[model samples]
Target: MAMTPKELLNQLMQTEGAMCAALVDYNSGMLLESVGSGMDLELAAAGNTEVVRAKMKTMKSLGMQGTIEDILITLTHQYHIIRPVEKHDGLFIYYVLDRSRANLAMARRKVLEAESQTAI
Candidate 1:
């Protein structure tokens, strides 16, 4: 069975040191569902939409021939991940982790797992 949006977000939050997780609509740059909160997830998710668009635009201009797997933004004290959902078009997963406690490799794998199970 496929996971619901809320279940997907919850699964994301289970990652060690996870701060926030949200299902973002790529076209509208809006959060469809979210869980956990130390920061403003809605704002961050929307901004990451711009990041995805810029990368897509660059890819098109350069004639690149691959889909974006994930975008990682490392901050001074935080790690942000933007993962485009492969099962559905026009959707992405926005996940935040604490740099001091989260394992990047595991987080990446977890996001991929969550993406695979996400239903909407």
Candidate 2:
């Protein structure tokens, strides 16, 4: 059975190094739902909306024909993830992790698994 968006996010936060996570609507820059906390999810959602749009636009301009699995932004202290929900158009998951605490490969897989279980 599929999990609710909240349940999925909750599961995601249980992964090692999870700092925060949110389900955001890229078009409106709104948080459909959110879980955990370290930074301002509202602000992050709005800012990331632009990031998603810019990536999509760039992909189109470049004639890229594939779907975006996820965008990873690595910082000195943190890792940011932007993953589009395959089942929900115009929506994406925003996730954060503490670099020093996270296992990148495992955390990334956790995000993918969480998205797979999410029911929107």
Candidate 3:
């Protein structure tokens, strides 16, 4: 079934080791919706917005011609994922997972599934 933005996030959180998830507007650096705890998703949304913007700018500067499917940030204890929503311009998904317990490949697959099912 089709899922609302929040429902999609909830589904994402069901992934093993999932910590938090949010739907963000990259254009405005705003958190449209979020779930879970530990990290401050509001601030994360704003910061990651810049991350997306900088990458986009760099891509243009290099004259690269392809869309960003997703951005991955690996930390000592966590894995962060940023995925741009296909149908919604300037919108994206942010998901965090614990490195030890999560299966990176499976988590990535689930995020892609959630991205596909999400309605922005």
Candidate 1 TM-score, C-alpha based: 0.97
Candidate RMSDs in Å, in order, are 0.8, 0.7, 0.7
Compared to the true structure, candidate 2 yields what TM-score? 0.97
- How high is the lDDT of residue 108 in model 3? 90
| Per-residue accuracy of model 3 over 31-91 as CA lDDT, tens digit each | 9999999799999999999999999999999999999999999999999999999888899
Give each model's whole-structure lDDT.
Answer: 0.91, 0.93, 0.94
Model 2: residues with Cα > 4 Å off, grouped in runs: none
What is the per-residue lDDT of model 1 for residues 13-112, given as tens digits with 9 covering 90 to 100? 8889999998898899998999998988888878999999999999999999999999999999999999999988889998999999999999999999
Better of 1 and 3 by lDDT: 3
User: Which residue ranges in model 3 land beyond 4 Å of their true spot?
Assistant: none
Worst 10 residues of 2 by lDDT: 111-120
Best-matching candidate per lDDT: 3
